[model samples]
Target: MDLTGYPTDFVADLGFPGAARRFLERRARHWPRLFLNGVPLDDTALGGWQLPEEPDTSESSILGFARDAAMEQHWEDEGYALDDTGEGPFALFYSRYGRPLRAGAITGVAGVPEQVAESVESIGLMLSGFFVVSLLTPDDPATDPFSESVLRDLRESFAE
Candidate 1:
């Protein structure tokens, strides 16, 4: 579907641009497949191949409405918020922002997991498939372009 990843600047500002890049690295030394239940992510626009199911949301929020559905309907089965809970949807979102569900360079979150989680939910609710958050969607192919490009940019910026 030609999904658009996050801008390079967004990842860099989070402080783990390199890790995020490596997380998305396509190099042989690096793993590209973001698998879950041993199955490749065929539904992904970025061709995730597969990523292990994270403790957080499973489907990449950047993929589209269906992915977002999976996130809210399935991933947060334990709980994000509740009309009953009354903590507000923001409570769950706070737990997910920028936190890596799966540990790695690219998947590594630049912000706090809770914050990223909350943001993901908020983004999903407000922005839907168009959500453009790196922390909320580190595995999203749309999170950063070519992982390598983002990493190179980060390295250059860091060096300077």
Candidate 2:
């Protein structure tokens, strides 16, 4: 959660095949909530908030709508942009505004608890360049020891 310790320059390394999955597998449980490209990974994390149905959109397009809605919630200011090259599921993940999403912005999303939103910070990763994985973690390492520890762990794992 602490950006001071995050290796922002190495963010693109996360796009390596299986890197995102391994990272999530080891650290996702420590997060209050997780999202994939703006879509909540766990519906319960939203406290039962359901995506509103669009009158003209079909069921199949609901996922896209959900992604857009979620992105609009916090990504309006500064967020990572993933450039999908459509070449074997590899995309480039880079900061659009050179900063992470703020807690105030994350709280604006429907169903996110205030405490959870305030206590957590946002981190985005590109999964094999196919999709984006966003994680909400504690803002301080002291609040959640595992939060800071994972940065080192991930860097080592990714290096391999």
Candidate 3:
């Protein structure tokens, strides 16, 4: 995979090859759900992202639209529920976690629906599950786990 088009800031903050390896390790320990532009990597139409209740601290936040009971209710009311496991279309692109992170949205990457043969596929793997990148917005955000602080925490947690 070619990572030539991924965001420079993300690459700089979290070392690429190391970060990618770490992400794979993290995925092995838990479910695969990476954040990019505040939203998890999903092709579903009604996509939403989560944010921290307290932005000042480094602790993970549980605030999210889809995580809301109402949203779940709405989906249930419509007789639909979000899948709770496994990789979807881009499983091969994803690492051992068996999931694909959404690096397709970032600039320089190929557009969605386009065929990608050997792309390095960049994505923000939100390790905390409830945290998101503090730097970019949904409109112009990097992949999830974009938070350097949270990444440091993840490294420590994994080290233990």
Candidate 4:
């Protein structure tokens, strides 16, 4: 799909429960296949992306248990403190983790290095998620493009 017109700067108010689902559903009308962190997310993925309506009493009750579990574990491994916050799915995930990390995006064409593609895709998703989180949490400002603190951290990390 030609996602050249994808609105990277667009911010959706996904503060309420089920808002993410609705938003995704609406967007699917135009872009049926949405990519999050380089992974394809379609209608089937949406079912898994959402929080279950009921407790995990039976195995069948959980639609995307393994995928969700892996993702949660991945987030935890990446230093995010995934807590039981009563916020929307994306809002909850992005607000706590996305804001602090200040993720950004990049684009590449075919034949791009695997590592570069992965890094750029992940950064793009993080940045977009961060934008959504910022809208949900208006008091918390988004990271400045030319942040001295970030620059200092980079310099210190790279210093030998």
Lowest summed lDDT window (length 10), candidate 2: 83-92
- Residue pairs in steric clash, candidate 4? 104-123
Judge candidate 1 at residue 121 and give its lDDT.
44
User: What is the lDDT, from 0 to 100, of the residue 140 in candidate 1?
Assistant: 27
lDDT by residue (tens digit), candidate 2, 87-118: 01011232212233222332232234776665
Can you give the lDDT of residue 113 in candidate 4?
A: 77
Candidate with the greatest lDDT versus the true structure: 2
Where does candidate 3 have its weakest 10-residue lDDT segment? 86-95
What stretches of model 4 exceed 4 Å from their correct place? 1-15, 51-93, 96-132, 135-160
Q: Write the per-residue lDDT of candidate 1 for residues 33-131, one digit (tens) a residue.
A: 333322333335334433222333323332111122333343345232222222111110111133422212233333447777555542312211111
| Per-residue lDDT of candidate 3, residues 49-97 (tens digit) | 2221233334422212222334334333432222232111111111112
Assess the local accuracy of residue 7 in candidate 1 as a C-alpha lDDT between 0 and 100.
30
lDDT of each: 0.30, 0.33, 0.29, 0.32
TM-score ranking of the models: 2, 4, 3, 1
lDDT of 2 at 73: 48
Worst 10 residues of 4 by lDDT: 1-10
